[model samples]
Target: MEFTTALFYVFAAILILAATQVITARNPVHSALFLVLAFFTASGIWMLLKAEFLAIVLVLVYVGAVMVLFLFVVMMLDIDLDKLRAGFWSHFPLALTVGVVVVLEMSAVLWRGFLTVGRQIHGDSGNIGDTKNLGLVIFTHYQLAFEVAAAILLLAIVAAVALTLRRRKDSKYVDPAQAVKVQSKDRVRIVKMKAESDRVTLAATEKQGN
Candidate 1:
């Protein structure tokens, strides 16, 4: 077998192992680490496919940023592993059905591309993984779709913020309107009183004791 094919198998094996560990690992941190490994291996596979941009992005964005964030969150959060596992069996059937549906859908879409005997559809050969070309194509050919996707992402962000900002009894927040309208007198009171001497304080204390 060719070196590239061998490398593909190696990466694929590592990816499968890492993905399995991601789901099976007891510790959330360990699962996150395993997911990072899976992303790395998947990046390698993308590199092998000459999708250099995708590979770099997978390494930089998902592995570097997203996975690091996931690791930090997993490490910081107090996760009850038992509680997490408790509902797993209960949801297994639904999960299995969804998984099967996804697999079948993906297979249906991708099986044709995997066929070696049939005439394969060739893409632009000028620059296989050129970021410039990719950007131009996206901006020119799929500009509307891209803009729609961006809008959708923005909407999702807004929705997420709205959801998290739901009024809670425990959440302490200041009203901006009230804060802006507040006067110095409302915030602070100046009580002009005579400063008593320590001797007077002691006499007062003694009198109180008596």
Candidate 2:
């Protein structure tokens, strides 16, 4: 076979192995590391496919930003591995069935494309700097779709924030109207009470004792 085919197979193998490890690793940190490896291999495959922009974005956006955040969250959480694994066997049958169905679906989809050869992406020529034209095409033709996606992403962000900010018994909330009306005098009180001398108080206490 050709060198390109061999390279593809190597990257594909790495991706598959990493993905499997991501699912099967006992430690969440290990699983996250495996997922990063899988992303790397998938980016390599994208590079091989001449989707340079996509490969770079996958490495930068997913690996650099998203995966780092995910790893941080996983590492920060106090996960009880035993508790996590307790229901594994009970859930295994359904999980296995779903896994099998997914595998079959993926295999069916990929088997057809796996045999296909290369073509120009977005009708652009096989040039190195086609990303600019591709972006122009997307922004021009799919402007409405892009805006819709942005709106959906904004909605998701709002939803997540609302959920995370759910009021608990101990949660302190400030009234904006009260906050607006507050003044320095309202916040700070000047008490005008007479102070008793420590010497006089002591003398009074001694007299009382006598």
Candidate 3:
């Protein structure tokens, strides 16, 4: 077997194992860590496939950003493992069935290209060329789909923020508009004390005459 082929198989095996562990691990943090490992291995596989742009993006975006965020969130949550596992056995059968179906579908899709004969089809000729081509395709043919996906992701971020931001009636919060509209003239009062000065002068004169 070629060295590249052997390395490909190794990376693929690692990715599969890590993905399985991501779902099977009892600890949420461990599962998230395994998912990060899976992303790394997948990126390696993409690199081997000559999709350098996709590979780098997979590592930078998913492994570096998304998985780190997931790890922090998992660690922060006060999760009860026992409570989580309570219905595991009850859900196992259905989950297993779904998993099998998914595996079969993936196998069928991959098997479709099994007998195809070709040299290593490099999606990206080189580092710079690949990025330019990727950007061109993304902005041209796939622009609408990309925009829709971005919109969906934006909605998800907004929903997550809304869910985490709890309203407290006792807590004082400033309204930005009201604060911006406030003026110094509305806050300070300038009162004239002309009568007080005249009264003081009259009292002083009366005292002096006495």
Candidate 4:
């Protein structure tokens, strides 16, 4: 076998193992860390496949930014591991059935030469191929789908921000609009007073009453 092919197999094995660990690990943080490893290995596989743009994006986007955020979230949340695992046994049969159905479907599709079509497409690429050509095809043919995906992602981001803005009784937050609208005239009071004569007249009236 070619050296690249051997390395591809190695990376694939590691990727699969890491992915399985991601789902099977009891600790949420550990699962996230394993997912990061899976991303790294998948990036390596993409590199071997000569998809440099995808490889770099996988490392930068998933491994660097997304995984870091996931790690922080997992650490900050108080997840009960035992509670999470409690229903595993009850859910196992349904999960296994779904898994088997998915596997069978994948096998039927792949066995009918779908996987070969992917290899054929990749094999037809020239030595000078780059992300520029990929971008052209995506923008020209799949522009609508691309835009829809972006819109979906934007909605997800807005939803996340809205959820984070939910009212919390224990939290103190400032209203920026209220702060900005305050004027100097509204903040200060100017008081003018007479000299000690006015004060002495007020004191003499009190003494006469006594």
Task: Report the C-alpha lDDT of model 3 over 145-205, residue by residue, as the tens digit.
Answer: 9999999999999999989878789988788999899999988989976788899999999
Runs of candidate 3 with Cα error greater than 4 angstroms are 115-129, 151-168, 182-210
Answer with 2 or 3, whichever has the higher lDDT: 2
Best model number under TM-score: 2
Scored by lDDT, model 4 comes in at: 0.86
Error of 3 at 17 (Å): 2.4
Q: Write candidate 2's Cα lDDT for 7-70 as tens digits.
A: 9999999999999999999999999999999999999998888778889999999999999999
Distance (Å) between predicted and true CA of 148, model 2? Answer: 1.0
Ranking by TM-score: 2, 3, 4, 1
Collision count for each candidate, in order: 0, 0, 0, 0
Best by lDDT: 2
lDDT (Cα, tens digit) per residue for candidate 1, span 57-162: 9899998899888888878889888888999999999999999999999998798667753663233554546677778778887899999999999999999998
What's each prediction's TM-score?
Answer: 0.69, 0.71, 0.70, 0.70
Q: After the best TM-score superposition of candidate 2, give how far the Cα of residue 76 lies from its true spot, in angstroms.
A: 1.6
lDDT over C-alpha atoms for residue 143 of model 2: 82
Q: After superposition, how far is residue 179 of candidate 4 from its true place, in Å?
A: 3.9
Poorest stretch of ten by lDDT in candidate 3: 120-129
Question: Which pairs of residues collide in model 3?
Answer: none
